[model samples]
Target chain A: MTGLKLFSRRILPQLVTLAVVVGLISIMFPGFFEISIANGRLYGSPIDILNRGAPVALLAIGMTLVIATGGIDLSVGAVMAICGAMAAWGITEGYGLGLTLLMALAAGLACGLWNGLLVAVLGIQPIVATLILMVAGRGIAQLITEGAILTFNHEGLIFFGSGSLFTIPTPIIIAIVTGALVTLIVRRSALGMLIEAIGINLRASTLAGVNTRVLLIAVYMASGLCAALAGVIAAADIRGADANNAGLWLELDAILAVVIGGTSLLGGRFSLIASLIGALIIQAVNTGILLSGFPPEFNLIIKAGIILIILVLQSPTIRTMVIFLSPAPVSQADTEKQAVNQ
Target chain B: MISKKALVGAGLLASMLMMSSSALAQTVGFSQIGSESGWRAAETTLTLQQAKERGIDLKFADAQQKQENQIKALRSFIAQGVDAILIAPVVATGWDSVLEEAKEAEIPVILLDRMVDSSDDLYLTAVGSDLVHEGSVAGQWLVDELGGKDCNVVELQGTTGSSPAIDRKNGFEQAIEGHANIKLIRSQTGDFTRTKGKEVMESFLKAEDGGKNICALYAHNDDMAVGAIQAIKEAGLKPGEDILVVSIDAVPDIFQAMAAGEANATVELTPNMAGPAFDALAAYMKDGTMPPKFIQTESKLYTQADDPQAVYEQKKDLGY
Candidate 1:
């Protein structure tokens, strides 16, 4: 009974969401469940759900960490755009794949460091600091491309986008591996505790000798790396870099996924698995909308409605009401004893 | 103190005398959509340059692609008592009330690069490419190339609620109507970005069985088509050969792509619609000559047969 209650408290929301999505998709498409597994691979449209979910999953992983520290990074999408443009520019300028990848990663790290300096040293608000980068990054991307779409003749880069290992897409593989590493870091390292402390009580944590500034910067830097990796995969898939629309409006979806995964925007807790599940749920919803014969415009309304429903479920008042509405009652003798002890 | 007062009185008298002798230049207020695309940047630069050359006092305001900001700028322009107004609307709808205000102010308005959905006839003329014609030319070229054979095509659309997206789709459908063999298996808006174009094409590739059946692609603009070409190449198929591609807007990169045999063809939508636009605006300003409602620009289709290097040079000269 205790285990069941704990699961309900910790994991039930994601599970319920998964069930609802599965039910809806299965009902709408008759053959959704019939998957053929051949040569150690599962073949179907489900592969697309996983593939499309990868970039958002990467962003959500980083966003979950930042939100746990009571901060937000609104510039991930722009960072991705800049990184993509840089990679494409590098490759087109006759640089090898290794150099291009290194440059892209370095650009992302530099952007994060810039954001960290503003937020940690200069005392700018996280949103304001990142927002400046968000506005400037796209401009920088345009400058690099000269407002032109750049195509490269690099095969190794294309492989990252289209190649598969054991029949699994490279992007999906990267997402899963990166997600595991992030999960391990947050679960096993002292950094997670420090972040939680800072979020819960900043003054007290600083007094307790927690390096709040460094942790905050690290979180943002990690977010930058994640966004950069997503950019590489995206650019690789496209085999080109487009400054105009690469990673556009992606930050919104990342934030939504993090919030839906049960991380409080106000800070203090995060669930990596839940966040991944949140990314999957959103992708599934999008695919479901496409397969349901509804026009694409309805997808926005459906996403907004789902987010609202999840937020309502997270309300403290609703949880309390649900608890009170249960048929089981607490023992009065124990309550009286507890009162006397107090 | 007496000397200082005499000097101030002399300066005021001199300014008043100068003001009385000189006529105030006609001010043309312009509300531009933000510099989101290369074409938008070029248009803004041309408008400013032409205004300066013609000695028109152009008060420019950028809306950063927001309708509210454009409306605010227009109201301010009206308040400033400008003689004329110009607007490049971000979206086609929601301009009735604001345009009515401009009409009440008796200011002649010109639409540039885009059109609004107001029935008030407040604007003098729209100067832009026939977007539908551009799309039809692309479609007609593809039809001629395919020779009415069965071909599956995918499309990358532009931003929704925009006039170009609606008109381009309509025109393409009209051209491909009787050609039943050219089938559009997948169509979605890439919002006129290279990334979304690539992303949507990626999904299309994954959904289809190895993307072997996709015969051709059509994009509302060249940027998305270029992105689609990337996707096609990444899928291990030749772009221009295995899958013929066509799009509107002969951006320089499209020419480069065509030169490299990655893209098949594109219809030209010259970004230099400014010259003729200013000509019409000048007439309206000088003599109150109401120009025709639609001033259409010519569009041409460019294929691999055309020397891309020469086309590139010509387009670069046109400030593309």
Candidate 2:
């Protein structure tokens, strides 16, 4: 596919939705997009959106591939908690940053391997397999923290959370680099196509010598690594690891990001860039809610209403209806339809 | 079988010394609602310490935040035929049958920190702090400290619609009533966690012109206060100095913040509910004196002036 066609087909819808949301927010708060540099870091609502969206964005990076492989992970949030607790425990124990991060990432990888073994090896359903970890992972995290918020004061460790390079938050930097690296690793190789083939028809792909089991396990491990990075950033942000609250309900957000990015949950085609945009959209709505000065009670209601609109706008049926109703002169929609058929 | 035989032997020994004063070496079973938080862990520690100080044999059971586990623990306590029982119930309902069984066994049950929905006769008395009064103490401290200054206070509520959150909000509003100088500029729920607390406080700081307009912040709990303290500092303003922070639940971390002059005051929801319960139990055992239906634990306020460092040192080892 040509670059322009790919951009229009995959990324345009999310960009439109994001622009609309940001526009609405700017209307509510005129200074929403105004950026100022203070304390050697970019400070603004837009910057906060990127910074706060980093965890979901990072999770969505791995989630896009997992979802593309026809698998769902409900344990990423719990894994994040466990990983954050691990990092905090290690840091407070006087361990250096490298070892602590390795320990946390290893814990995340172990959790992912457990899920992979249950699903890929034992042939369990992905949802049920991941649900086991989803329930038990928080307990494991609580155990690691000893049912208390484990706090650390290491500045080097905290830089991942609050530190900035060139006025960009470290989390934003981490998310962008990870997204770019993962995109290259998949797009520059046959891995993405293989995962998509397995998602479309596992038996056919396996018969075609695809090595489905190993690939599936590898996808889960990738997810684990992403969740670990997100967890470390979260722990560093607060300077502590709160097992009960860290990354709580964040898996749902990550999944929502993937769905909003126009990725089908049934799996097949995927785009990492689109999912990153989706993550930003979610964060924008959240930050907007905070800035809108609405009562806390209305926060969920407003979010739900806005998300419903965006989902409806992205619906294929709605797009078709729009094409029929408008019948534009240039007929870009018709060409796009032809491209999909081809 | 061994546990049963030992229990019978202990019961026989107790009966043989029925005429003794105060049931001096009495056995009591405590059903704790697991160590879900540092405060809960501290409560468990204080309960054990109280039991040891009273020379009571405390058979402890951790319910692990499950009502069924709590019920099972209470049944085992009943089977053991202990002198009395203490329960920090995980929930308010589904406890009638269990408390009835304890009553039938002639084992008076005292509740700590939380109350049950059963009829009052099921338990002797509940030892807990009045959550609203704790909020009132925190608000009263802020009000008196301001002394009619035009203060724009931001409130960080606990979980939305939780009993503590609702009661604490009401109590604080009640305390600040008629004080036109003390105005509540904004209120939001932080879900009683540090992360949400910091996030909400950051927004409050931004909306209130970078902490210049906000004079005080009242959080429903000290954990949120600690979180908001960091936010205040990050916004390039002093917490206790620029924006006074007063919160409820004097957890150990809050005292550390207080010592650093980062937090202004805190109302302590003491974890020593067992101390009062043990005292009441001792009185009842010595001379069947029926205590009141509800025993309210003191909601003490601590300020920077209260030797916060000493308080922090004292509270650090209580498992908090």
Candidate 3:
């Protein structure tokens, strides 16, 4: 009963939403669920979701933390471009895999530190603080590449993008390991509660000796780190770094995934796993549109329509209405139980 | 007869005017629409090279994609009394006033690579490649390669509803309208990016019997083609062998892919718009002759046979 309660409370809604989206896709293309191994790697629509969703899923993990701290990192997409360019530049210049990865990480951390300084130290609004980097970050990336697509043929670094581990793609493996590690770091220690506490009431949390300022900066740094990893994967995936288009407008997708996962932008409680699932849902819809053979013009419209339906279903009143409208007649006791579950 | 001598006299006057114009190097001003992409950068580099070769004094302005900056540059050129002015307008509208200012100063204006909404009389001539023609070139290449053989093609389009995306799709469809043997089995937008192109192609390979059913791929741009080639390679299928890859915008990377025989062909969206614009301005300066209102640059197609390595070396330095 405890396990059932935990499942219902934590992951059920996101799983249901994912299942519904996958069902809709399979309806459009009957072979959507078929998975086959080719070239010693898993190949199918499902694998595509997890593999393609890796970058955003990683971003969502970091975004969930920042959003929990009542902040947003709009510069993540640009940070991705910067880090990807750095990696591409490094790899092409024969910096080797380890040094390239380290350089990219440092770039990401530096961008995050800058953002944290502006927001936490300077007392600027999170949106305005990150917007500075969001605007100038791609320009910085372009400058690094001298305004071109920096291509690389480094096999060792490219493995992080397309290589697989025992039939699973490398991106999927990286995302899962990162997500699990982040989840353990937060959940295993008092870090999760401190973040939630800060989100709930910053001044009070500070008075309670939560070290709000340092924590806030650390949260933003974590987000930056995630964006850096995502950037490397994206660059490696294409075997080149496209400074202009690498992570264009991807921050919005990460935010949308967080919101769709039922994490409130208003701050407070959050779920890392739920947001990861949200990323997969978004990718599933994208993959579905591709497999559906729809005209390109309808891609955004269809995606928007489905997202609207999902959002509407997520509303508290709509969710309650949906439960009430079900075949099981709800008594007063059941209503109270449902309310308690919510 | 008197009429024959009169014609000779008129010819002498024209020749003298041409000689006088050629004796002095013309000073012209160029306002480019920023280095927004590698292609635009290449256009800028080539424009500078073309000016050097013709011994024209070119005052270049980087407008950075702002109409106001372009307007300021035009006004400055007019003040300096340039021989002619060339502009690649960032946006289509809001050029009437500055163009009129140039007209009042008697400075002939030539538009490059992009069109303005102002009247044709406001500028000397507009030089650009037809985007629709670019698509048709790629499609026509596939049709010729297939040679009436039954084949299936998948297309990776540009951003949804974008002008290039819509026109390129329509143009490809138009070129293959009567070809029953070639079918566009699947079509999707790659948003003119490599990541989306690769992702969409992976799905296409899976859906079409692990790519066994697909015979060719057409991308709206070389970046997408470069990406789709990688996808085809990862699927354990030889890209140029198993499936023909054709795309538009012959960017430098595409040439590298072509050299390696990963990509089959690419239609060049030539960066030489400035070459023709300069020629037209020079012609007008020499004889007061009015060139055509629209000058279409050639949409040259390059294949493996075209020595992709040499082309790559040539374009790599152009900042593309």
Candidate 4:
């Protein structure tokens, strides 16, 4: 009974939003849900959403934890650029595939460490702290590629971009595995509650013997690691590292996914699966717009309208109003649920 | 060994004397927008090569995409009393005061690649390719290739609301207008990047009956076309054969794709804007020949017959 209640209260909204988006796209294009085996892989609009949504989903995984601690990551996109650049440079310079990935991962970890130090040690605001890398990370990436889209023909590195495993796309595989690992590390330990405690009152949590600084740094490192993986996948997908464009402006999408997942920006409880679904919802809308045959000018306006509706529906007052407008018996039980929720 | 050294020293001295005697080599200062794109970098390289070929002394300044830095560079060029000034203004406005200063110094300024909103008399001439014309060239080639066969085309447009996206889309549509056989079935913004191009094309393929309905693919730029070509291949379709590919911008990678027969056509957005600018400047400096206010560069088209392999080899190291 508790599990059922938790699913209905915590994850139901995001799951319903994703279903509606997919259903809407199917209505717009009759062939939206048609999946078939092509080139030994599941090929369809849904797969494309998961495949294309991989980077944002992975970022959302790290972003959920950070937001759960009352922090934000503006540098993940830039860090992705840096890591992609590092991977490309390593591959071209003959460092091989394994070393190249390690190099990219190390670059991401270093960027995260720098960001963590600024926010945790120096006591800078999260936005301002990450903004430094947000501005400079691309410049550093450009330097690595020497102001060009660094292309490589290494088969090993390219496998990470678009390769499949057991008929599943590599990017989707990476996203799911990383998301699950992060979920386990956070939920299966005291880290989850500690993060929430810090968000509610940082000084109080610190006084209560939470190693706030180390935990903060670890959270940032995880975000950086996720970004690095995203960067590798982006570069691998295109078979090159485009320093100017790799994961450009995707941090906002990650934040939006977390928000749409019903995670509060003020930081508290977070659900990894909900954020992942939020990312899929965004991708479904993007793919739907492409298949709608509408003019390009209508793209952003339609997306904005849909997102506005979703947020309005996610509002607590709106939910309560919706329940009140529903059957009378349901409203009485919903008020009790709301009471428990508070 | 000493005699050999003396001979080499004498040869070097003779070359130095000859170089100094050619003091008539005009000194021109070029104020360039920063290396923002691969095309811009190629343009800079070609500009330096053009100056060298003409025995002209060129002073170059990169403004790093800032208008203030450009103004400073222009002031310094004027102070150095250069023979002429060439500027690729990053923006179209805020050049009136600087142009007035250059005009007062009696130094003729030529605009390259991009234009300024300043008065016509402020600069001698502006040299650039017609972006719309480039798009029309790509479209015209497709029309000529298909010969009125009924076809469904998919378009991968550039970044939304960008000038190139707008102008290129207009030009292509205009060229294909009144053609009953060629219909553009679907079009979407690819954000003018390879990754977005591939992703959008994937969605396009899924929407268009596994790409069987798409007879040809038109991209606003070569990068997108290159990416779309890959997507078509991944969909188990030969890009050049099944869906004819036409795009603008003759970047080196696109040439390589053409060499592999994966891409069909590209219209060149030549990076040699400085070549024509130099010619006009030379004429203006000599015998009071004032070039026209706007000099448009050629938008040459390339096909499979154009020896794309040789072209690729030539352009591979131009900093592209």
User: Taking the tens digit of each residue's C-alpha lDDT, what string does model 4 give over B180-286?
Assistant: 99999999999999999999999999999999999999999998988888788777789999999999989999998999999999999999988898898878777
Residue range A1-342, candidate 3, lDDT tens digits: 997688578878889999999998888888887887878998888988999999999999999999998889999999999999999999899898999999999999999999998988898999999999999999999999999989998988899899888999999998999999999999999999899888889889999888888888999999999999999999999998999999899999999989988888977888999999999999999988888888778889999998998899889999788778888665767889989999
* Interface RMSD per candidate (angstroms): 4.5, 1.4, 1.1, 1.0
- Candidate 3 CAPRI category: medium
- Sort by DockQ, top down from the best: 4, 3, 2, 1
Question: How high is the CA lDDT of each candidate model?
Answer: 0.79, 0.89, 0.90, 0.90
Fraction of true contacts retained by every candidate, in order, equals 0.22, 0.32, 0.92, 0.74
DockQ metric, candidate 3: 0.64
- In model 3, the clashing pairs are none
Top model number, DockQ: 4
Better of 2 and 3 by lDDT: 3
Q: Pairs clashing in candidate 2? A: none
Taking the tens digit of each residue's C-alpha lDDT, what string does model 4 give over A96-130? 88999999999999999999999899999999999
RMSD of 4: 6.0
Q: Per-residue error at B51 for model 4, in Å?
A: 0.6
DockQ for each model: 0.19, 0.52, 0.64, 0.65
Which residue pairs of candidate 1 clash?
none
Residue A229 alpha-carbon offset, candidate 3, angstroms: 0.4
Reference-based lDDT, residue A137, model 4: 99
lDDT of 1 by residue, A58-143 (tens): 99988888888888899999988888888999988878889999999889888888887888778798889999989999888888
Clashing pairs in 4: A161-A236, A161-A237
